[model samples]
Target: MRGLREWWRDLTDLVLPAECGGCGRGRTVLCPRCRTALSGAAPCRARPVPEPPGLPVVHAAARYADEVRAALLAHKERGVLALTAPLGVALAGAVRAGLREARWGPGDAGAVRARGPVLLVPVPSAPRAVRTRGHDPARRIALAAAGELRRTGTSARVLAVLRQRHAVADQSELGARQRLRNLAGALAVAPGGDRLLCGGGPVVLVDDLMTTGASLTEAARALRAARAGAKSAVYPSSAGEGREERKAGPRMAGPNEGGGVIREAICAAVVAASPDSFEINRN
Candidate 1:
């Protein structure tokens, strides 16, 4: 597994840089042109085909292509830490878009705007990956994004309570099912973390990129799996649910009844997603 991980890391173009993260324009970290490319568009639904069962509706600020792809690799694989800000800004946009249309479940209902606090939970990177990179890209970006959202007047914070439960094979070449099986039971919330989520607001799964939606699915599974026994509260899976709950305004659940419910978050956001995933959403 270690060798496979190293081989997969090598597969990415982690070349040392001398130019812009996006278009490699000289004398800039990210040129104006590439920055615009990274965030110029409105977020869109980018659902993977054969979408994993527990995966929620996800939004992406840009397709993972051209400059967006280049920039992501530069920041994540090559450790260009400066890119965290702009990438986070892009992710913030995606989070807003995800919240705007978020449904509590699969029932064509529950679309509430995140007028209050928003919790951004990043998918956990592998321990080995984090050690190799020297920083957790998703968490770093999530913090930047939380700042961006607060600047824009929506109360927000990054809740990095998820952790990898164990190592798995490198997922670079795995099929959708293969990836799912490999990652199944692979993530869990930090001990007592769900206690923080037992109240109000939307909980969004955040990630830098989405290739097959496997990691997000696993993250979601872990969140729902935790024993939030009182209300047994969960935002419930699916993209088209969440209407009445918003109007009723959940309180912390005691057995999900005494206090507010964790806003039953059932949505996600990403900086970029496979261009094909966006295509699937359009059709």
Candidate 2:
């Protein structure tokens, strides 16, 4: 079934040539210009100006403007799904670097050890956005990343543990602060999924872009809440931090629930950072 689907997709691409994601030229998914532009791997932090609370260190493969942004938009928003392979390769490279940067040892890194599984959790997409796109782009990217990880003799998994409980404003026009505010309570981990997180492995969050990182931060929060619960767990926290359940907010989750200890995270994407707030590492 998968083989046939891929064959059909290849046939379709041959019939309808796609413009180069980088240069917008016809007959290619990525043109020479974009290929050259993204040929190298340079990872840098996509920092927050004010830097929201619990925002872990994030490393991006390239700047998000020009050809990089073009490639990402082309593949992600435009249904240029064929680009997943190239983007996945690029993401895998970034992830490997990020894991190295964090200094995670062999047994420490989830993707390295054969004993435990590595969970790549993607930031959830809003219901409306998913409906309009007919699929979840980030989730698809995560799956591609998992495939890349497995190809290199690593055990990986994509845990779609995030879900939106309510609608929120779109992030296209929002500034960093506004973006943080808009997504503050917009994510949650579903019930009965905590066991997957506590199974003892690394949980890396994957995303297509990192604009201020508000979404990923919230997603990490959900993971933290989930990881806080283990069968033979430590002592419970104080009242405020206790697992006082509530109705699912825009995004709500329980405590002690996590995908295990996230020794490090790698936020990989096809393109560079956006121009407005992106900082490239010239080193």
Candidate 3:
């Protein structure tokens, strides 16, 4: 069944041909100009207004505009699977920036060396959306991003451990606050999924784009709750600090302890972020 579907998709692409997802140019999956635009000048911090309580700091490769916006929509909505490689490369750039920000310091040799097998957790797509698209776009991009990371000497791997606890209304027509309300309490870590996060390298939440950041906020909430539960079993004292950190707002991982592990997310990275979410560094 899967093979036939793959064959059919290939046939369709061949028959209709394709244009660059970014520019709509003829006979190319993505043109060079659009590809460069997708990569951005550099990954930079982005935050949504009234950011959700557990939302971690996020980095984005490019602003969601023009070529970047078109490329993302084409891959996500139009099923341009070939664009995943370039999208993943863009995502990898953001991930590297997130990792750099999470580092305690350049001198922390142990933390630097111990950062291995980092987990790339992609946000779960709704089952209905997955069925309609005939593919899980976020997970595919994450897999490609992981490959890109590994090739660049970071031990990264995609771990799709998040699952939707209930159905959500389509977010197309919703405003920011409405989106948050609709997604609240809608995601959770899969059963026994906490084990993957325990004592492993930092887990970075990943997605193709960030709008209101409600989705990533909800995802971090689920992971942090699970991490607190897991930490109580190992480092009971740190549990209080974890809760405190949540109250303070989004935080990246701090210095590592001798035996205790900081299980919270280091940060988040995405291929693109809404233009309004860009934070100018004034200092």
Candidate 4:
């Protein structure tokens, strides 16, 4: 049934053809030229930008201008589902780099087990936006990144832990400060977030873009809060269980476990970012 559905969609697509998303060339998902532009080196962290307290360190894939911005908007806003694959590839590259940074001091085999798992938690979009887009874009990208990580033998998982606690005004028209204000009380960890973190792993925040980084900051705060709750739950239980606790419980913990230590450890990656679009006076 699914095969037939896909075949029918393909046939329909062929009949009323659309141009390539990356290049606007007739009858293709992406043209060679744009693909060439996109198929460059892996993305890295940009210079630090101030974010809300305890926000994670962020890395972006490409400057959100020219071809990159166009490609991102084309896939995100338009019904360009095919773009997700390549975009996911780009995102996966950043995830790999972030994971490497997180896991760098690791040892092999038994020693590696001491470090625990890596969790990728994506910033949540508004419910209305998800409904209108017909997909959760960040989650979709995170899943792809997780798949990529698993392929490379990293135990990565996606935890959609962040949720909107309040409705935020539209961010498009807001300046940086306005964006931060709009999102001030807008996000919280989902229920069961504590258990999710307690079970195992450090958390990495994921987002599609970072302008003022207000959204990512909120998400990081939520994840850190979850990690703290997770650690507190473990201690008394671990003490109560005594020596037996070591056998059954998760060995490693999330970022907030040690010294209320958030690990400076927070890392993030995106497919693109606003290119010097932020004005100092706009602050």
Candidate 4 residue 118 Cα shift, in angstroms, is: 2.4
Q: Provide TM-scores for the models.
A: 0.78, 0.76, 0.84, 0.77
CA lDDT, every model vs. true structure: 0.79, 0.65, 0.81, 0.67
Instruction: Report the CA-based lDDT of candidate 2 relative to the real structure.
Output: 0.65
| Predicted candidate 3 versus true structure: per-residue lDDT over 1-283, tens digit per residue | 9999999978977755468889898778778899889884888888877676667878899989998999898888888888999999999889888877777223342574486577889998999999999898889999999999888777788879899999999998988889889999999988888877765777889999899999998988888878768866777676456665555643455433232234345579999998878864432
CA lDDT of 249 in candidate 4? 34
Query: What tens digits encode model 2's per-residue C-alpha lDDT throughout 1-283?
Result: 9999999989977766557877788788777677666647555556646566676556566767688777887776787887776677666655655455554323355545733666777787888888888778788877888898789866778888888867899898998789888888778778766677666455667787777778877877777766665432643442443232322211211122233232333332322444433433332
Q: What is the lDDT of residue 212 in candidate 3?
A: 90
Q: List the lowest-lDDT window of 10 residues for candidate 3.
A: 254-263
lDDT value, residue 164 of candidate 2 = 82
Q: Candidate 3: deviation at residue 54, Å?
A: 2.1
Worst 10 residues of 1 by lDDT: 104-113
Please state the error at residue 151 of candidate 3 in Å.
0.5
Best-fitting candidate, measured by lDDT? 3
Off by over 4 Å in 3: 1-17, 104-112, 235-250, 253-264
Provide C-alpha RMSD values for all models, in order.
10.5, 8.1, 5.9, 7.6
**CA lDDT, candidate 1, residue 3:** 98
TM-score of model 2 vs. true structure: 0.76
Ranking by TM-score: 3, 1, 4, 2
